[model samples]
Target chain A: MKIALDTIRHSLEGAIPGVVATCDANGIPNVSYVSQVHYVDSNQVALSFQFFNKTRGNMLANPQLTAYLIDPETAARYRLALLYLRTETDGPLFQNMKAKLAGIASHTGMAGVFELRGADVCRVLDIERVPGAEAPRALPPYNWLTVLRALGQRVAGCGDMAGLFEEVLGGLEEMLDIRHSLLLMWDECGHKLYTVASRGYVHSGIGSEIPLGCGVIGVAAQYQTPIRITHMAAEYSYSKAVRENAGLDPQRLETAIPFPGLAEPHSQMALPLLASGKLLGVLYVESAQDMRFGFEDEDGLSVLAQQIALNLVQLQQAGDVETDTAAVAVGASPAGARLQIRFYPANHSVFIGDDYLIKGVAGAILWRLLHYYVHENRTEFSNRELRLDKHLNLPDIDDNLEARLILLQRRLAEKSSALAIVKTGRGRFRLQVNQPVQLLEHEVGAAL
Target chain B: MIGSSAGIPTPMSTTAPSPPVLRPEDADFIRSGVSVCVASRDVRHVPSLARGLGCAVCDGGRTLRLLLVKSQSEALLRDLEKSGQIAVVFTRPSTHRSLQIKGSDARLETASSGDEQLVQTSFEAFADDLLTIGFSRAFTGLYYQHEKSDLVAVTFTPDDVFLQTPGPNAGARLEPLP
Candidate 1:
């Protein structure tokens, strides 16, 4: 009886090495061990091209082939009749396979030796189960349909980008049973990803950045593909190793806050958030146990990321609106403890009484907001004014204005500073300063 | 030294300039807790695989012997019977150092007295290797368990040897043993 290849995907993850058999033109057969058989789709699977061997030669001469795979959880064996298609040396599939192979190689003690030259694509003609008397019953890793349904509803209910970020991270933990995860937004100009929200870590790691093509997260964003590594590979760990390997300038690397990752992560999955052919960010997750995240986990997270990307685009589009200048009159200056606010014009780094608060677009937003409050006597602001503010230099009109505001608000709350921003309504927010404020602006390259 | 006095023909030599032969240096590497997988295909091209319990080299390194658990190798054993062709891969779990040997003449025989000890030693070494890499002892123990009665011996003469390591010169053959 023929079965669909998708139903037995656990066998393709390289937990139990696959075996491939091909016959030469002279009817001589050859069999070889396959490190991994990547599941491209229901009808297609790609084998890693690490070495030029008889199997490859036979496949080039005779496309008829057979492969055997075994499920790690259950001892069920499957036989696949395949037809050789083409080889992909680059692209999303190749990147995904390459990243995964790194982890496998490292785990098997073949880190530098195993390099992916290409992905040999094959058409799975038919799949048959190798009948065995022992039927092992193992619990399914996760119910993808159930988790996706519940997560879709949760994401849809989020009224704003902030709520969407919170719900997505929370949903991953509560609904999908994923304990550790992070959400990073893409910095297209800088070729980096900045951490905005994360769960299951001692530190939130907000504002930490990783360069594109540097680590697993960066590679996923660079190729706009999902990279899942079942074993922890030191070569792909983010932060210090990635920064050092990339040979990034120390000053530039210093600007990037260290990523909060497990000291020894055995399983990791990074999925790119792509919408309309543009990468928005990456959703990353890791575990201390080996094989904790399987193919099902990657598929589920990929679907969830698609939903998030769509919602993010929709929320950003909805944030573009006209500002209300009627409430320009600021409240009377508060009589209390003095709070010092300093802003650096060069990099937009903001500090509150010697403690660094934030920088970049969020810092610029805060600087402008405070300038209006102290000088222009404006306590209320809208997303439109911020987007239209030429001085702020937002990357685009469709910039994530609302998301930036939310991030700024959260950072302030976390710092417990005397200043706060409250959402008054859709597209509008109000600043509430509890103490007398001393605002200072510094020239470029000036020390605080 | 390309052909040498060893009977092994080094089939991969024609494909590439270098001839890769089974050498003494690779003997311990292959036998030291490396992952061993044997593969064969039925007449209709349906492949079958079974994890080898252990492996041994004899006949001046020209012949290879693989020990497999009979109960777990129903399909693979049948495939071996249908066609005398077989391929076996020996890969060090830690280094991914690998070697693939193809044989045209294959036959099954009863397990010899020393073969049980070979299986036991390989199992222990493989478990230790996996433990170093963070695999649970329980998982490894259960993964390689086999009953003494369930063992079978598969012996084949090496017709071809290929460097299965991942690199630019991976498939290149080496000179035969002098």
Candidate 2:
């Protein structure tokens, strides 16, 4: 049945972050968030989706479908029916979608600034009134990483609290588009900031020590409040010791921010890591772009950090799983305690020492990150490439990848002595392990 | 050269050992020479041709013709036939170097019907390594009038094709693809 234009408009207005789904000939489905939907005619509407999505693939394969728009808060639903028609440059439908999109892009302040490409045209046939489907099941409130930690609790238990901390650190990096993310745990006895887990800048001798409230990272430790700085002048006002610390070079940190070659602008955010109302550590994310973090980012990161705190507390309560498992497996001798390594031609993982071996797509992603530890390479690769490498070609990784890494990092900490490795960052495929071990080992029997 | 001597008229002093004359555009596609004699074109569905041989019908001498593909897809041929799209299929078998295939009504998927065997066989025979397939809009300057026009040229390289016959005729030259 034909739905009226006014009704469609009302339905769309309530559906913030509308979702569009498309399928390829191979039956692969893709879904992404779209901004606003514009009605071209009574029988047609157009919407702009996040660039480089699977919906385009589906539209090319089978053009008939409907879009689901939902209310994020109340979880209400709206459906817009559409018929994606394959058209050339001169097709009337193609021109219509483009014209409608131009207005929306301009209203969003994008206009011609961002590289906005148009996909094949599809006529929006009708708006349907479908009852709201369940909001993509509210991701279990228990942080996935925390859940994995609990599952592994009985099997391996949380061994490396330090490693668990780093896994959580990585999750924070991903949620927020911050380069050079670091988690500095507060030492109650020493009253100092120590780099427990870090990504981005290299750790020289000086970064290892900072008195509480002496620097930007340290002040967050002291105050237990989240802080953000748009410029270094603001950072200097926070802590005089931070202004002089060898690690606090605003110019160099600017160069090291993710997305190399864009070093003109700068932004920074620092958040406290507290579990049970006790300061566990501080997370710092820096960007070379101004106004980089928006309300969505702030909210997402706050939730992510809170989840990390829960995981850290659970790890502490479980006691060190890695040490207990390792003492039985390896003798007190240093050689016996040395972390054992194994490599697989394709994908490989094993339960060694305290950490579980995560190979294949998990292995590739983890390996790429740890490799970054040796020499900080923050080249942003596409999600497709990262997923293909990790063999997890599902649309999203920011959630699943972190869950897996959290398990891996905690397990590795249990198995090995080095507690400072395995940090995560904003980019896809990142791993930071304290031990600089070569992933590929030479077999003595095969070589001369 | 299984059935070449019977159906096709051979030129004087032509032998299977002699190299076949190739159209200029198709020469690069036949560096190693023809390997099999599948059908040039097929009008009716005929299965089990000589147990392993392939067959198709071509209107003899069709040079390249420009067409447009409305939808870019894995089933490219099917998408081409979906209307408002353009492409060229062969009409009959002929031995002319400069062939013309202007406005010829042709059928696609005559042999395989639904299977992609002909496309597979054609790719294997034409280029052993299966380099590239000819699609619409290759010779755009000559064919397309407006930038928005959906037109592409389909160039067929017949050098890798053998006429099913007793022997090859040296004077049998292929028409140039676009």
Best candidate per DockQ, number? 1
- Put down candidate 1 lDDT per residue, A1-448, tens digits, no spaces: 5699889997899876787877665445666777889899999999998877778888888887778787765667777889999999999999899988988888777788778889999999988775443345667756789889999999988888778888998988887678889988887655677788889998777777788887788889988999999998887887545646555543333253557878788999999998897888899999998878888788888898999999888887777654554656865788987789998877787888887887877888998988888888888988887887898778873356776787688778877458898988778888878788898889987965
Tens digits of per-residue lDDT, candidate 2, A1-448, equal: 6657544443443123344544344322233334445444556565543254334555655675446554333334455556765433433333333333343333334445322244344576555544322323344333544544443342233344545654554544543325566665554534554444566654311124455665445656676655443333222232345445554433212111122111232445557778777877676676665445433344455565676667666655343222211111212222223454444433233323334444433344545544443344332232334444434343331223333344445434544554323342222222333333444433423321
Which residues of candidate 1, in runs, are more than 4 Å off? A23-29, A133-135, A241-256, A321-325, A445-448, B1-86, B90-98, B106-156, B160-178
> What TM-score does prediction 1 earn?
0.82
Single out the weakest 10-residue window by summed lDDT for candidate 1 chain A.
A248-257
**lDDT of model 2, residue A83:** 77
Which prediction has the highest TM-score against the true structure?
Answer: 1
What is the overall TM-score of model 2 with all chains considered together?
A: 0.27
| Predicted model with the maximum lDDT | 1
Tell me the native contact fraction for each prediction. Answer: 0.23, 0.00
User: Candidate 1 has which clashing residue pairs, if any?
Assistant: A109-B94, B18-B173, B19-B173, B19-B174, B19-B175, B20-B173, B20-B174
